[model samples]
Target chain A: MLALRLSRVAHPAVQLRRLAVAAASAGTGFLLLCTFGYALGEPEHSGAAVLRLSWCAVPLAATVYLALAVARTDPGTRPRPGLSALGLGPGRMMAVSAATTALACSLGSLGALLLFVQLRGGLRALPLDGGAARVLAAGRPLPVPATLTLLVLVPVVASVAVALSLRPRDPRRPAAGRGYGRFGAYGTAGARETFGAYGRFGARLRSGTGPQAPAAAEGARPASGAAGGRTAVAVPAGPAPGTATVSGPADALAPADGPADTDREDADGPADAEGLGSEADPHRPPAPRKPPAGLPWGVAVLAAGLAVEAYTSRAVTLSGPALSGTRTGSGPALPGGLDVGSVPVLVGWLLTTFGLALAGPGLTHLCGRLLQAVRPGPLRLLAGRALMEEAGRIGRPLGVVCAVLSGTFALLVLGRGPASALGPLTALGTLVVLGCTVGTLLTAAVEARQDRSATTAALVRIGAPGTTLRTAAGLRAAALLVLFGPLTLVVAYLSALPLAP
Target chain B: MVAPPDNDVLWARALHFTHNDGSPALSGVSLGVRQGEILAVGGPSGSGKTTLLRCLSGLVPAQRGEVWFNSTPVHTMGPLARERMRRDRFGWIDPVPALVPELNVWENTALPLMLRGTSRRRARTAAQEWLERLDVGELTRRRPHQLRQAERQRVCIARALAPAPTVLFADEPTAPLHRADRAHVLRTLTTAARSHGITVVLATHDAETAALADRTVPLLDGRCVRTVHLPPVQDTEGRAACSLSV
Candidate 1:
């Protein structure tokens, strides 16, 4: 009830975010219920119905994940500093967040139920519309138990996900500032140390006490107070053996041997990465190192997928000599079917998609490097850097979208017609899945943009012109399209080729 | 160091600011800065150093104060005018780098120039020069996440200096750097400001940083309690050294 009240009184932006989550849930729920209704209609093909319903779960799951992300970043829902003093601790705040998420999803599920029941006719009878009766067990009664089960699925999954993602870490640390529970930079060295790499994924996301800049690094020079009057300026250490002093200031900060002057690895790359020595080392100077070339794991997975597809494309064809006296009852095997079986083909497609997804971040990083390899202008530099920074955030979503497109393309090729062979219900299911996945990816991008807002604001304050930022954003989009657009087309075409008649 | 001239580039009188929560951030604070002069605002945390800097730079208008930038009344200017002034005449460096994580050191440094509609080639060239001047030229290809704290702060200083703003507002710009790097960056900043004739309003807690300034104003509880002037130090050649690397 408190969650619902808070939703009512929350900032418009927070409310809007929740509304989107609710809407997505409604769409997912509608799809799931439709699948369940179809199952009721076709009790004879109950196995197929179950499979279709399971497919519906994919989009529903994506929606839940997005909803959880939104909740984590919602400013109105975040616990403020001093709230714990009022007896609302981190533990209580987390519960509030989870409850709020559950309420939003439950609302969406209810919307889906109402819409489904209305579209199918009324609650009085199972109203199958648009000749769905022909494909389903048309005259059969709708099973209440089955329908209720499907309706509750979204809320249950979403709430549990919210609970798991938002559980409190250490209660001792005060809930302080912005960027807590946020997906990008935690901003505080303390928070970064406590949460480690897991914080970036919205896991153990800690809110800050306020919008204060993070305190300086631990064990460094202690900050001089007002009483430390007129302290002498620190003298620059002599340059290492071979280095020459340029301008006094520049010479002072210059690393004698490059970025390796310090033993501290914490400041090296991303907080999560240990050694990316070749790429970021300032001492190496000129020649760009080659990107890691071995993709043996991807290759092995791709080969396995190809073998599966090939076997499935043709039936079990047995040689007469090999089966001479082996089977008396079942003599010779003529090519059994066009493909080994739909199940094996599906599994192959899944493996191929997973391999591609795994390879996405590395490929994106390479694309970033390529952008700056030439005579990079300001736009190219900005775009390239952004791609490198956000490769992890956006890569998986891009991969998922690519996989869906490729799978749809292959299926279309196998059918060899503009008319979808999967039929209307199946087509609708696929659409929901693809659409929700893309939406989830877009939400991630939004979160990333939010993470960069402070930097943007700082730039603006310093008199950075607006066009520079806009151009940078445009360049990023363009570069991503240029790189991924072709890859998607090629993967779709190749995957579809094997099944072509 | 050159003696401060009589003419003031920026002057603020009787400034007052109250937060939305009713906490006073600045209370009747007043000061003046000469062109090419480096003025330091030294205080403890919450002593209103940052608030004073923001008010004088036209980032936040004080509810009760008169701010003049070379005879133009800054406090009375509209939002667009203030923004235009910031874009064209002023540069700011925060305590933290606050660099755009997606941008490399050069691109981040050149951002203000690019935003001002300078050609891509020109902006990048200017950015590269500043990066070299700050000794971070080799890391031009590196993004913020790829840099150490000191390297990142150097890039921030380069970005602020590249545009050659009339006045620069730097709030504890050396907070993140190690002791050695801190002196170097401060020297670079003071040298650039002097060479370029850019007025500097620096806010810091470090006495070393303030000692390099032409004058230091101590703020306490959002009010200026006192001002101190330091005698310029002379190098072996008998030239007055205004730099922090004494």
Candidate 2:
């Protein structure tokens, strides 16, 4: 009851996102009902009927995952501090989120059922196929129970998935700040303390220490604090520039290495002479350290996966005469003439998709670094930083979109290969799947934008023109497209080459 | 009431503003800021310090008073004009820094200049100059989430100063820093303002922060009660040890 009431009072944006989820659900429902119709149209081929229904599951599952992501990011659904005191903790909030999702899916399922009935000449008559009275189930009527069961499957799977995904964890392990990695919020352990301390296998370069390349292996160097017992080396948040460091009672509580080193280091830095002049007193400390950079190993992994897939498909094609009639017991292709190696190829494609998702954050970080590589104007800086910050949140969704794109292209190529290969139902199924995947990617972008409103407000307050922000947004989009567009085409071409006649 | 001086860079008369919750945030507040001077707006929490600063900076227009910037009535300017004025001629520092989480320290500091179409190299060079001044040059690559509260605020000050605006509005800019750090930040801020000929309007409840200013306007119940001018301190570096009474 609370969930229903809250849904009505929620923000309009939340309502709009929920509507998108409902629309995707409705599309899924329609596909499932058609699968059932196919079953009734050919009850004798139970295996084919089951196969068609199972194929519907892929798109159905993607839509469910998308719906869950939308729910998780919706600010209206977040548990408020007051709500916990009112006996609505994270567990109750999760239940409410699931309930809301279920309600939307159920509405869509109902719409599919109504549409199916209307198209089938009401509940009383079965439409015959082109005067062939024996083909459209002939005398076998559409089983109401079976049809209802298939219709409800989408809603059931979606709601259960939502519940499972949103269910509260132990609540003891605190959520990581900034979405990824083990770093706690500032002053605890930042990216510097984590990857830098661990001496990550790549992307580390030692400057000023010597002309030596950093060790390629993770174990080549001692941990950051191993030698000096420099535990908790707190870099004092020094007084602002141009001011003398003030020693006071508050200094006692700071960790041992606070501004004591800061004043000295401030004097040693070269830029100090120009900006601070002689006003800032001099002291000495070790040279300042640069932030850590992680290697983009994920990209290498994805490339290798695609290359292996291409090789496997070509090998299969080259020995086609020898392998003819050697089915490998993977069973017959379902209506589309897919080969026995289709399952393994599909697995390889999935592994590639995962690799792309994993590589997304690092590539995004690199994009940010490169955008500002030149003497960056403010516009480039803002955009670059935004890309780096949001890489984790949006990267996986982008990877998913790429995977969908490749899959769609490959299917289109395969469809043209065999006559009667692309049926009306199959085409409709393809459209629904591709559309939902794209919609999911767009929803993730919206979430990233919402997360940035505060930063936007701060910039505006500090005299940043709106055009600067718009330009930055445009730059980020262009950079991502420039980087990913060619890569997507290359992968699609390579993967399709071996499969095509 | 004493008339605003002819040389005042910013002047406001009988300003009034109300919050969205129907509470009055400012009432009949008037003040003037001299060119290149640090004017602190001091009051306890819930007082009109922030509201007055926002109104003076043209961030929020007052419904019932005149806000004149060098003979131009800021209250009557359109939004685009006000935005342009802010972008080109004013700077602001919020209490919590509020740096863009995505950008590292240097990028965040250089934003205002880049927004104005400054060349990337020039803006970064200028930004680095200030970052070094603020003693955070080494952490230029660290994002906001990685910095402690004090580090973030210092970066914000550098960002504000980088633009070399005519007037800088700071609303409790050092509220999150420890006493010693706050003193240092304030000292750096004032010295930089003085050297650059930039006018500063600082809002704070802390007497120490208020003491760092050349003059102070005390607010009570959304209205200015009095203005106090402090005598120049002989030892600027030792002013942190000086006792201040509100």
Candidate 3:
């Protein structure tokens, strides 16, 4: 009841975001209904029916992704200081967030049901009825139980995902090693690390399970893994950048040496210059000693994704000699005589998306560092640091956008010079995935901007000319575009070439 | 709108301004600041001190009236021109510290200078010098999130001073600091302005802060109640007994 009231009173923008979630859910639900229709249309081809059902997963994932993104950015769900007095603590807020997501998804599911019923002629006399009768198997009686099950899928899965993501945990629990590592409004982990610390590997970096690269650390390294397997480190947050005595990974060999040297420097370094000991400054937040991790992991994921796609395509192509009888359960060629939409190819595409999402934060951080690599003027330096800080919040969504675009382009390439293998279902799926991914990216950008508004106001007061800020914004956008555009095109080409007829 | 004297670095006449919602913010207030002089605009909260500073600093144009900086008609300037003017010659410090959260202390301090096309190296050196003077030199590499409110405020002050603008508009610059820190920062600011010939227009409700100025203009309900005109530089000592009565 409280969730419903909050939803009703939310800001129009917040309402709009919730509506977007509902729309995504509707699309996913529609896809599921269509999958069942395919099964009804061709009862003999159960394998094909299963294949069609699996295709719905793409839209399903997209809907859930959009729902979660919207939930994170929802102002009403966010916890405030005094709210705890009224029994709305972190745990309660998480439940509210989950409930809110479920409500939105349920609305979408209901919309999907109405639309499906109308199209299938269930509501015979309703306005705007009649279309896709043959494809929807309108001649047959729709199974009430299955239809209801498909409709509930989105809301159930979306709410569960939201609940799991927002579940309150002890900050010291480092073993979970999942989700983005970005700090949220409450400074809870992965409020955004740029859609976040780019998931599990980012968690690994945050928890200091991975070795810190010496160059990135600049000086004395921090201790690996806090007491009781926490992300917290015992070293000082501020270390002198000039005190590098050793090179390479510090955690790998001589892990003990890192703390000893760092403690001495922390005592003798900033403490003296600050005219206070480390114990004197109690307000400083613990700084991450190493640069954000996950770049290598992202690269590896991309390579593996491409390799899987390439191998799947090659195996499909090489099996051509045996033709109809011996292709080993690939569910026969499509009407175009192409082996596209096989389960292996689908798995490869998903991996590519995952890889791109994983690599995003690390790549964004690197972009920031490179911006300030040269003796950057104020513009580059400001732009660079902002990117690095926001890498976690924006990077993963950015990666997903890349994955969507590349997949769309690659599939188009495969469908060329033929009857255009993109059926209505394929087109609808593409549109939903494409729209949701872009929406997620744009939403993440908006959240990042909101987070940075105070700093922006400070810049304005500091007499930073309007043009300079715009130019910096342009530079950041252009850098990301330059980085992602080519990579997208390259991945598209590599993935499509093997699958192409 | 009589022309201000050439010697007055900042001069405002009949500066009537209204907030966007139609509330009066500044009402026909007038004041003049001579070259290298520290002028304090003293008032209680919502007495238009910040609005007055904004008008004088080219951050906002007065709804009505004329403002001149060294004989240039500021009120006549467009937004871009005013923005350019602010960037080139004016510096501002807000009541609270608001450094870019992502940038480290030195980077934040050097931001304005770098915006003016100064080399990063030169900006860093000047920023370091000002930061060291303000007792925050050691904190230069720290991000704003890691610093205390008072420490961050000092960095803001350092940032404002690093560019060495022709006029510095400090609006409750030390509000976040405790007594000891406030006194130390104000001393550094006033003494530095005196030595470097940087004209300062300080806005404060604190009597001690206003006491550092060479002249004071007190305002009430967006209208100045009284203004104490400055005597010749040779006739008065450096301190000005500026305050509000009523």
Candidate 4:
């Protein structure tokens, strides 16, 4: 199974691209850290500092690449480039994701062990006492055992747990409606019926009333009358089946049956009719057309959010002070040594903040596009429907993942002593992330439902049928499932990652 | 042969229809189709035969009077209910191939069944049987675009019959065939529909084809003026031969 999954991942061109990008980023970071070490006057522990910087580059590269991959992946269709295309059941996909995460954690732990070994050598070279050597050695053993255990067990346990516990049910089977019980008001068949009714009414209003007539009259009349009263000659017939012929004067007289009574009412009616015919036919005027509908709210919201994030990230540059520290930046300042001027810090902050802000609107736009592809409609409502439908499909799994990861990270960070003071702050940040996700999903749902209802009502007035309405609903539902599922997963993972807090 | 008595209540009153450009396509057309009878409507190109069929099916609106489908005012019914009525009761065949191109012949045939929520396997089995009956079972796996004109027509016919609709409105169903194929098609349609007690309302310009019907009504400029009835031919048994007319 491991080989099969890995092979699937290998097939994507994205994997190679990711590896290349990670290598480049780490190489650049290593070079910069080496420059800084040399400029700092080659301290006794300079080699250790260089090793620590190099070790840190690995996770930085991995995190950056993963963020880019997740952000760029379109949620509504086939997996993005570089993702395994093994046709793994949803269950298998979940397992694969878990395995990937565990692998990353193990790699990070190994890098940390290398950093500890280098730091220990540097400490011994600094002429520290025998006690310090013993402490450094003891600390060196600590990270090694942890790193070894993590490398072996993390992926295995995560893969097995995910495969067993979160295996996706067959999509063809009916899914249990989230947040609603079996007989709940929201997801019952009756709701479908109501929506169906609204959709049918809308389609009828759109088709209009001008075209339908008995086949006999439509086929027979043109050849027999008017247009210089030409003799009704039959056209060369094709060979399919069932043919008939029609006569001319009969068609002219058919519509004007009450002309006799009208003639009696006005002595000049016949002459008037003759004069009218000579003056150009008036029976064929065109009908007026309807106006187009306006844009949907969901689309508007998404656009606005994207604009805000773009503006804000560029506007605020965190610099100029260290908030009463020992110096400008000695010792682990700001909880995680995250220098504001550092490219990684700036980039990580920008992505995390901007991505969170854009999440709702992005989801809406994605959903809308998916719906439009399946069934043509206004973009705004399509987006709204997409957002709602997707949220429902992915909400539970995402919530569970967020809760578990945040809890685990909190436990690990708290166990690091002195960092325990920041535990509550991290918990608060996790809450904020979860709250944003839930809020975005709920907003999308409400907007989509509203748009569908409005469109259906409009179609009914114009004379559309139930089938059209049902089709629209189905389109909305499918769009939602496609656009929001992966997005929710990404959000959950991001929310659980260790931040400055 | 004696003429069948005319039923005034069954006749549809004259009505006018306008297009989107302030021009009228159909002007005051009137006609009637009785039970167990075939009504033929023939005209030149752009004579509004297709429009007339749309009006009959409640797909298009009429400017005047009521359209009675088994005595129900079709125009007054809600769009949803009207659509349901159309799907359940009327089988419409358009001149253009109307099958969804993505679906194969068997899938297209079983579409109505699937729409009605039948299990896919059962619906497909039924579709297979229907295709065999139409002598097109060999082409069941092919998509509509992959089939020849005649094969496509057969698949369409199979789709129409799959639902066993009350009335089948065919618009120039034979317009794409050759001479020999046309006669065979006409014979097959008439024979098959007769066996199923289906009323066929066909629009065509061929008098020879009209002669095959039990009764032929002529439509001139969107109006039905006269009707012709043909006697049932005697069979070898000579026991008042059965005629499939309506």
Candidate achieving the largest DockQ: 3
In candidate 2, the residue pairs with backbone N, CA or C atoms under 3 Å apart (3 or more residues apart, or in different chains) clash, namely A241-B133, A264-A283, A376-B120, A377-B120, A378-B114, A385-B102
Task: Write the residue-wise lDDT of candidate 1 on A1-501 in tens digits.
Answer: 766777788878678778877877787887787777766765576665666666676677668867877877766556665787887766777778888887888888899877676555555454443333343344566688877787778777887887777776542335336343423335342333331232134321221111111221111112221111111122234443112111222222122212222323344433324334333443221222223332356546756775776676454233322322332233221111222234566677777777666666666667777876676766676667667666766666676777777777667654362223455555655676676667667766777687667767877778655667788788777777888788777777666654454
**Which candidate's TM-score is highest?**
3
Order candidates by TM-score, high to low: 3, 2, 1, 4
Task: Sort every candidate by DockQ, greatest first.
Answer: 3, 2, 1, 4
Docking quality level of the chain pair in candidate 4: incorrect
Any runs in candidate 2 off by more than 4 Å, and if so which? A123-149, A169-355, A358-363, A413-415, A419-421, B1-5, B117-142, B226-246
Location of the lowest summed lDDT over 10 successive residues in candidate 1 chain A: A204-213
DockQ of each: 0.24, 0.28, 0.33, 0.02
- Over B1-246, each residue of candidate 3 has an lDDT whose tens digit, in order, gives 577888999999989999999988998898889999999989889999999999999888888988999889999999989988898999898887877767778998998998998888899999999999989887777666556667777888889888998999999988767899899889888987888899999999998889988988898888888654656567355445553545
Tens digits of per-residue lDDT, candidate 4, A1-501, equal: 562355245534434432332332333333322223332433455554454444343334333333223212212212333444555545446655555544443454344344434444544553332332332443323333433543344234434443454454432325334333433244343432232232243433322222222222333234223411332232234232112112222223334323332432242223233433212321111111111121233334333433443343343333323432332444433323333333243344334334333343344444544544542222323233333334433333233333333333533453342234443223433333343344333333433354346434423322334555566556655554565555444433443232223
Model 4 gets an lDDT of 0.47
Candidate 3 C-alpha RMSD relative to the actual structure: 11.0
Interface RMSD of each: 8.6, 8.5, 4.9, 16.1
Candidate 2 residue lDDT tens string, A375-418: 66677767886787677766667776776677567667543543
lDDT (Cα, tens digit) per residue for candidate 3, span A1-501: 889988899999889889989988888898899889878977888887887787788789988988888888888888776897899988999999999999999999899888887888778788767577787888998999999999999999999999898887654323433333322324333222333122234443433332233222433223323221221221223263111111111222234335444443443345434444333443332333345577888889888988987887688667764543333354644422345434576677778888889998888888888887778887888788788888988898999999899988877764363325667767887888898898888889888887778778878988888888889888999899989999999988887765566
